[model samples]
Target: SCPLILVLGDQLSHSLSSLRDAPDGAVVALCEVAEEGRYVPHHPQKIALILAAMRHFAGELRAKGWRVHYSALDAPDNVQTLIGEAERLAALYGCDEVRVTRPGEWRLWQAMQERRDAALPWRLVEDDRFYVTPDAFADWARGRSTLRLEGFYREMRRHTGLLMEGDSPLGGRWNFDHDNREPLPEHLEAPEPPCHRRDATTREVLVLVAEHFGDHFGALEGFHWPVTRRQSLVDLRHFIANLLPHFGRYQDAISDDQPFLFHSRLSAALNLGLLAPQEVCAAVEAAYQDGKAPLNAAEGFIRQILGWREYVRGLYWTRMPSYKRANYLDGQRGLPDFYWSGDTELRCLKRAIEMTRDNAYAHHIQRLMVTGNFALLCDVAPAALCDWYLAVYADACEWVELPNTLGMVLHGDGGLMGSKPYCASGKYLDRMSDHCQRCRYDPKRSTEENACPLNSLYWRFIERHADRLADNPRMKPILGNLARMSDARRTALRKRAEAFLATLDTEPAYGQGAHS
Candidate 1:
């Protein structure tokens, strides 16, 4: 009898212990199914990237003489559910048991559990890929009431010895956030981004995705994301030498023209398991040691991978199933139609959506502040907004994307991911990017004919939801701002916002129900 090994989408890491001592005849399963993609109405490009990368990875494993049971989304053999497919393969192979690493999403993990003990002996091996383990996080959360990130982050530094100097942080400070917010200087030159030649396998995968998911959002013409460890190393080296020097400075800053900007575009690779977090962190550490990058830059870069990245993963494991349903502000507004199409007149929204459509990516701030903020201020329902984020972004995984979209962006978790809704008028965008300069809407007016849509919408959102929101400690200031408005001013703001919302019927965003 053979032992069957199940590989989930995000568990694409080669370092997964389930594959460490694989027997010669072991069966490995990788699937691309509609269930995975449509569960969240994933962006067309995000779907393409994962399916393409998975196909490439399966080919590599097959080249190593491993038996790979790869399933395309439209394959006849695909039943579209992991449990059923796993049992079918195991029964065919005459395997009495299955071995696999723990899954990332709580729903998938639960799905695996219900099926694992049904027909065979199942061994759920520990995932060795992440720096922190489930048990380690559980132990940390044991005696503590609140799992605040800063406290956990400091502990992780002590445990991993990253950014630490003899029991203290190297710079006598735990966070360099104050130094990390310098906006992109006009003359700041970005380094050359790395590119990889698409092998025959990847090209074939691309054709399959294009054929099957042609109507999905985003472009696939220049698909060059790293699909293997070898290519991922090249990307890491390229960033260390070229992008890291300025990464810390502009990591939070937004720019309309410079989509990739100076930051490392390695999240897709890192999340997909093409590159190990520790190895990537070590590469940046090496640059600091060799005097190739400044300490502020190097340590800041390292902290993202070693500190925040690991912390987020740990937090996900500690807070599950219940975390997804948290809606702190009780937000229930329908998602704007413009979210699907880049049809809005707001310059910042237009640029951000266009970039997402072109590349299936936008750095953290772009996602959080620009698009996410609009959704938050417009009172978009958390689930609908989160589904949009999950569907459109290439690097999104439920465990990672949900908390960010619902908690941080929407304040749906009531101040868990963020202290307040990441709501801001156009002035913030004007200061951060050049979008305001080109926009037809003026950032200065709160409720004029040509007022920024976001400006009117934000005030309208607060007024409509005032009864539910006025009491939150974090929301008091915004409430005060609203309370100070004269009756005529408030009426004008509501009228302007209502007009903008009414235009959604004809906007590019509401067309075709792209999310459906």
Candidate 2:
């Protein structure tokens, strides 16, 4: 009998290593295990999306003449665990070995390693879905004292021959980030993202999710994510045609009326294996070559996939098990109730959280500067913040989310992922967004009752960590500003922050619903 090829939920790509060149008569196995959906209290829509995609992928394989054995979550005889299902299927088929693509998460990878049997051998194939392999990234990082993303990005550009002219970058620059931070003008009209309607398979998964995971952290009403390869491709094309032209100019902008704001919103599809990174990058490059989009827009979009996404995955694989526990700032406060409820007077945070709850999506700025910045300022524990990020986002998986949350967002890795903490005052938010205008608190005031909490919290964080961050060359300017402030003013700011922190747990309702 042919060996059984197991496909994990996240490994839904038809080009996946285990599925590539699959032998005649090979049995492909897929399952919806309860443990995975409940592992981190994943958003209800996220669970539904994965299960629906898995079901659709299995059907696609069967249509291609492969023998597929699928176990639905509601199956009467379901084992409720991947290992148990694998063992049962292996015995039923009298298979001597099992083949699988390597899992993305460390816990799943370790589980596969521990469950290996000498009699029924397990063969783990390389997951070639990523642009760079883990071994290759490790090789690249071997001699570097600090593994910065820009250098790696340049190497990726050279390796892929993307936006390269002879030995130089296309526009004679490695980063177009400076061109991508303009705030969205009120008169500018942004295109809406493509919304994929749920099919029968997705609808069934939605019913199951609603019944089994009703108390999960997010709403399930607006669950419009693409759940199949075909739908994902449609979304990609739609984004390229309608949005890519202005993506770079307003990529960093925040707005009170828009949730997507000319963003691709393709991360969920990419992370779920419905879209390949190489193809996405190729399409963007083609758009630039064809004059549909400019160099800055194309390069900026490609850099995310070719640079940040790949870099974070490489970092996760290189440093894991211990990386999750890193807390450079020694932050130990519990995550505030507002994170879950969105019930706070901070208008920026409330809007960001509400959007996340409604759509399982938030632009990068909202994640890094709004919620993430608040966590850093208030000294919320890194582990707690990491868990919230992993649970709330539809695109989250440990490999991508861990480094982003612990290192970039929380600065918990002490500067491995980013040179400086992405800490900011309310004035920064006010300048970049319309939320501050509608907000009751004054962004310019730090010591008054009607002052924005972030203003005082920002100074409080700087003052508390000055001793540890003083030597950091990037932090000298901020430290100098702190030093210029009078001792009396500093004391007052600290007192205001302390009073706000004390009332965090008992704060009144801000927004109500599953997300809040």
- The numbered model that scores best in lDDT is 2
Given candidate 1, what's the lDDT at residue 118?
A: 70
Which stretches of model 1 miss by more than 4 angstroms? 72-75, 143-145, 462-480, 506-516
Model 2: per-residue lDDT, tens digit, 118-237? 677788888999999999999999989899999999999999999999889998998998999899898987876677877787888999999999998899999889999899999999
Worst 10-residue stretch by lDDT in candidate 2? 507-516
Per-model TM-score, in order, reads 0.92, 0.96
Whole-model lDDT, model 2: 0.88
Task: Please give, for residues 446-469, the per-residue lDDT of candidate 1 as tens digits.
Answer: 777888888888888788778877
Clashing pairs in 2: 340-516, 341-516, 343-510
Error of 1 at 66 (Å): 2.9
True-vs-predicted CA distance for residue 506, candidate 1, Å: 10
